[model samples]
Target: MLATLDEQAQAFREDVLAGLSAPIPAVPARWLYDRRGSELFDDITRLPAYYPTRTETGLLNEVMPDIAARIPRGAAVVEFGAGSQTKTPILLRAIAPAAYVPVDISGDYLNDSAAELQASFPGLEVLPVVADFVRSFNLPEGIDSLPKLGFFPGSTIGNFVPRSGTDLLRHFRALLGTGALLLIGMDRVKPIERLLAAYDDPAGVTAEFNLNLLERINRELDGDIPLDAFRHEARWNDILSRIEMHLVASRDVEFSVAGRHFRFSAGSSIHTENSHKYGPRGARLMLLAGGWTPIAEWTDPNDDFAVILAEAQPNRFAP
Candidate 1:
């Protein structure tokens, strides 16, 4: 269900407190999506160094004909983290679903995108839900009558840890029900130099994006973070097979949020995000663990990215 305003605020407060108290202080990446942060992310996607966006888009272009054939006409297309809805038009045009549900944590952006999409596709019913897709929420009216097909593009699943990713997939499985379809993008492991460069671009756009989180905290939570005291850093961990983003303190510093204060020693950092790259075997194993049966997969020519088409696994017992 959608969290109440107070509930959402309280959850944010608790998350901040917990993250600050951890040995490796960190904040949830979702908090980084205030209006400005969302805009910066949209910019990040267009950067020439960012391969996931264009590669995934290319995969969709090549495979949508087959992908659309599997999704029944008039099915409801529900997209998670529907930022800017850039890759959505491809699916919408190809599948021509009865309705479209776009879910995102950024309410304002979500609404704006929904409005633009509705204007572009007059006949398509566009419903934008402003709740975080990670939690349980009510589906839109009339969605229950149609076959639900989930579109989770942009490899956002990489943001979560493995367990959380599995939980999210299970949530989707339950929401979509048996026989529903899921089209998800997964980024593959690539060269460390390439991965690091993607997050730490020369333009400093990503640096601004990372630092903006502090600005957001300062604005919203009455925080007093010295933005200049910290710098954005992205590193690829060979052992973990993920790229990690951190806000490294340039010097000793202290900050407060909602009247509560926290401290950071020189060289200490707040881990912000992780993008885990998966190989084909790992991806399929993840799907099976989450109760999805892999149907087929598509990839770009270089195999740097993938779009997997999977169906909700059928109930094992007899109907």
Candidate 2:
């Protein structure tokens, strides 16, 4: 069994304490993918204002055939952050891979999705790997002969800065080995109003999603933090070409953790996440930087989002 919250996990918690207890509070977005946070994210995606999930799904439905065509027959498909495996069926129907691997940091949920998928596609093999694909990812050692296709269907790539995104893509390519195919979803830059609307939905679910990150910390770390002490704030950073999410302090306060006290000035904020919006040019540049060469791209009818197919470098696989 995979160790959950082991030594690395303990160190990660300590780092979170240090960052949050700083003169300014900052929490890494990585911590937000825990079970509670994962459920909150599912709720967030269902909100009317959150458009990435729906938009990306629509585009994928429109282009699954092309995605499948790019892959050779009887390929092995692996997905990262395979939530509910909801958006994957679109690709599965077209590609019908020899094996399906779904990897995610959420162990229970990943297994649940894998079980359901196994029932749905009995003929196809299903292997579920429980680990954070962001940190360090190593695929199975065998299967060198199967066509390895990486499917990152959601706009999850937007969570990383451009440089980090490049590194992540390179890591994914390296894991897949040479002659592998990648299907990635990317959110496009749109009107500022639209971008703002998607994050700050009318139902307030998005707000809860942002603040829940704090609650998640308090719950997991034995930290005493009044959830009301922090408020959710989302802003468009035009200069950075990204949407920044922060947990703003409601009042000047001092929080203690790891035997150390950290103070936050009222009105100051802890940066939690940044969602980068990319155009076609930016997307292609990012893929290239990550060492994956783009082979095909499909955009929404209105060109609101894009799903690009990139190939791992012929020799970049981790041998």
Candidate 3:
């Protein structure tokens, strides 16, 4: 079941208060997707520098027939994040699932997307669950009996650190139950220039997207963060194999959120997000660690991204 609006507000307050107070101040990436943030992100996906969406979509279009053939008909497709109108339609047409369950924290966007999707496929069932996909949430009641095809696309998995990523994959495994299948997209480690451009686009939309988080904080949690006091930064963390997004304090600045005050020195930053790129071996290994076995994989011509099909197989003892 979804939390009440009040409950969600409280969670936001608590998370922001605690996160800002921590030694290394950082907010969870999931909080970056309020309605305005979501809209900004939709714009980000279309920018010329943003290759993941286009690359993944084209790859999915090319391989989805094979993907559909491997799965049984009438399976329920449970998308971890809100369904993308652009990408979800492609998969839906190819798989022709009996039902589609899109779970997301943004209820309004979810419903709008769901309604549009339902119109596109009137015969199929479109169920939108309003909850954070990072946490455990029950799928709609009737779909439990159907085979689940977990659709986690757009390299959203990259948002979490490796350990958290593994835990999240295991959470998906448990939620989908044994024998369920997962089709996930993962971005590859590419040239630093390309990666940097993808995250920190020249057009400044990405900056708006990052700063909007602070705007959201001010709007929802009664924060007084000076938006201009910080700037958006995307850096490649070579040691960690991820792109880190940070909001750096341009000068010493103090802000209050939920009646709690916080200060940051010039050059200090609050890490807002991470996008971990994975090599083939690393991706497969991470899946195995998360209780899923990679069954098949597809990639674009440039090899900038991958869409992998994995299954929650039965556990076996190993020497």
Candidate 4:
């Protein structure tokens, strides 16, 4: 179930306060999805340097037939972070699942997207649940009767740190249960130039997307952030094999969020997001540790991205 508007606002206030209070200040990337942020991200995906979205979409187009074959017909398809549901129709048309459950943090956006999808694909049962798929939640009514297939595409898993990533995979394993299937998209390790370009596009769409977080803070949490005081910065962390996104202070500035004030030095930055890249072997190992066994994986021609299908393994610890 979705949290009430007040509850959601309170949680947002608490998270922003806590993150800004940290030794190295940081905010959760999930907070970057207010209406404006979401729209900015959609623009970011279309930028020439943003390869992940296009590459993943192409790979999905190529592999959906095979993926659909593996997914049992009449099964319940539950998708995490189903923004736009753009590539989803490929799988839906191929598999013809009994029902579609899309879980996203933005309730309003989810409803609009779900309504459009339902209209586009008449007769497919569309059940939209607004929640953070990273955490736990109950599946809607009638879902238990059908076999469950979890769809977590778009490499959103890359957002989490390693331990959290494993925990998220395990959470999906538990939710889907033994023998259930999971189809996921992961960005693969690539050259630093390519990785940096993907996040820091030349057209500045990505920069706008990153800076909009502050705008969201200002609008939603009654923040006094000066939007132009900070600039977007993206760097490839070779050691971590991830692209990190930050909002660096262009000049020394002070801001207040939810009545709590904070200061930043000229060179200081607030970390906003991390996009981890993975090799097939590394991804498989991570899935194995999370009680999932790899089934089939496909990659684009340049080896820039991958779509993996894995099955939930029996949980020995289950009572």
Per-residue alpha-carbon lDDT of candidate 2 for residues 21-74, written as tens digits (9 for 90 to 100): 667566667767777677778888787778888888877777777777778888
What value of lDDT does candidate 1 attain over all alpha carbons? 0.87
How would you encode candidate 4's per-residue C-alpha lDDT over 65-104 as one tens digit per residue? 7888888879999998854556888888889989999988
Q: Which residue window of length 10 is worst by lDDT in model 1?
A: 310-319
Whichever of 2 and 3 has more TM-score, that candidate is 3
RMSD of each: 1.9, 2.3, 1.6, 1.5
**lDDT head-to-head 2 vs 4, winner:** 4
Which ranges of candidate 2 are over 4 A from the true structure? 1-4, 21-25, 315-319
By TM-score rank, best first, the candidates go: 3, 1, 4, 2
Best by lDDT: 3
The global C-alpha lDDT for each of the candidates, from Candidate 1 onward, is 0.87, 0.79, 0.92, 0.86
Candidate 1 residue-wise lDDT, 1-319, digit = tens = 7756676667777877788789989999888887799889999999999889988988898898999888898999989985345689989989998999998877788888898899989999998888878888888878898999999998898988878888888888888888999999999999989999999999999999999988977887788889999999998988888999999999999888888888999999999998999999998888887888889999898999999988898644101
- Considering only N, C-alpha and C atoms within 3 Å, which residue pairs clash in candidate 4? none
Output the better candidate (3/4) by TM-score: 3
lDDT of 4 at 287: 83
Work out the TM-score per prediction. 0.97, 0.93, 0.97, 0.96
Query: What is the descending lDDT order?
Result: 3, 1, 4, 2
Model 4 vs. true fold: TM = 0.96
Q: Which candidate number maximizes TM-score? A: 3
Question: Could you tally the backbone clashes for each prediction?
Answer: 1, 0, 0, 0
> In model 2, what are the clashing residue pairs, if there are any?
none
Off by over 4 Å in 3: 315-319
* CA shift of 176, model 3, Å: 0.6
